[model samples]
Target chain A: MMTLLFILFATSMWLGWHGKRKPAIFVFLVTIALCAFWFKHHATSELHIDL
Target chain B: MTPTFARKLNVIFLIMICIPLIGAYTIQFGRGEFPCPLCLLQRLAMLGIACGAMMNVRYGIRASHYGMCMISAVLGACISTRQILLHIVPEPGNTGYGSAVMGMHLYTWALLIFIATILILGVVFLFDSQFESKEATSKTRSVPALGAVAFWLAFGITVANVCTTFLECGFKQCPENPTSYLML
Candidate 1:
């Protein structure tokens, strides 16, 4: 899950750097969605601690 | 560099400012070293400055310089005042707030950098001076922007790596049997 977040973050950052603002924004939103999903699922289940 | 090029440079400057701040978090969380009050204060100031710089890049040079200076001033004053107090008192009982209340290492290098940042922002704010005004026209601004961006990019990536390390380590405590240093 963390890895996925990192990948998404990297993708968004790359998109932003490459001057694709719309895609970058989309990627950023996707990253946030992934993070939320991860938090709701694996974060608590794996870490056993509320983040 | 061209004016458009300079605007891009401003973005880089913002990235540079993010580096150390991220490093400090890494040092604290990754290394299990807790941040003292002054350290936290400095971090807060740096965060504000970084955000301001990012905003400036998102907007323009004039906006970035002014916004950064304003935010830096607030954080700088808080950290600087704390440092001055630490230097004067240098007693655990004299400290205020969290670990600061217990007193911790002064981290003079960090303080120095904070001071330097304040000074740099001051100069940036004064960019309206005759010399700076001449430089602000289309062509000259690009060089500074480019330099600023390069600096920020290097700084940001370095610090972000540190932050990543901290997230991995996931520790919340300062070192046991910690050493306390006098501020002076």
Candidate 2:
């Protein structure tokens, strides 16, 4: 899962470097969404530190 | 705040962002401690922040590009804040997730950096002169030598992270407290 995030970032950079700015931004957004999804679990996990 | 100088500053800014990532690597390899899932996510946000500055350097500087950075910093702060909170209440002998550096956990430091990114971007945004001349698009403009070098440096780190993360997490979810590279 973590690998996927960086892969998206690489794709975005490649796209941006090649002059595909719009798609690069889109790919970046996707990676951010994926990161957030993974983070949601960690955030909501029952931590011993309540709230 | 001409676009030319802004590009140079962005290059320097990109290099600055990579420093923490390198620091994380040193801690990972030097201290033999692996980053947890949350720690990995903070790196993602940092790289995302770098990506915005990278866009500014590669293409002509644009407000949208800076917007990209501010959004990333905001999300990163959320992740870092949550991680800090998770450990703040503390449990017996738990101490925290990873080893401390300079008396503060990495996540705490991450939150600080995210806030700094947002603040820096906010101030940079004030220099409206940098956003002039939208006609100077990526095709018309060539990045300066330093800009290209910094761009590659940040991109290289992201690519390197891709390889390291694959080895660490494999196709499976990362372990809560990673001790060794999973694929290795």
Q: Model 1: which residue pairs collide?
A: B9-B145, B12-B149, B13-B148, B13-B149, B15-B152, B16-B152
Worst 10 residues of 2 chain B by lDDT: B132-141
lDDT of each: 0.46, 0.87
Q: Which stretches of candidate 1 lie over 4 Å from their true place?
A: A1-51, B5-9, B87-107, B126-184
| Model 1 CAPRI quality | incorrect
Please estimate how well model 2 matches the true structure, expressed as its whole-model Cα lDDT: 0.87
For A1-51, candidate 1 gives per-residue lDDT tens digits of: 333444454454454444454564465556545433432342121212233
What tens digits encode model 2's per-residue C-alpha lDDT throughout A1-51? 889999998888888877889899999999988988988976657655534
The stretch of ten residues in a row with the least summed lDDT in candidate 2 chain A is A42-51
RMSD values, in order shown: 11.6, 1.5
Predicted chain A of candidate 1: TM-score:
0.73
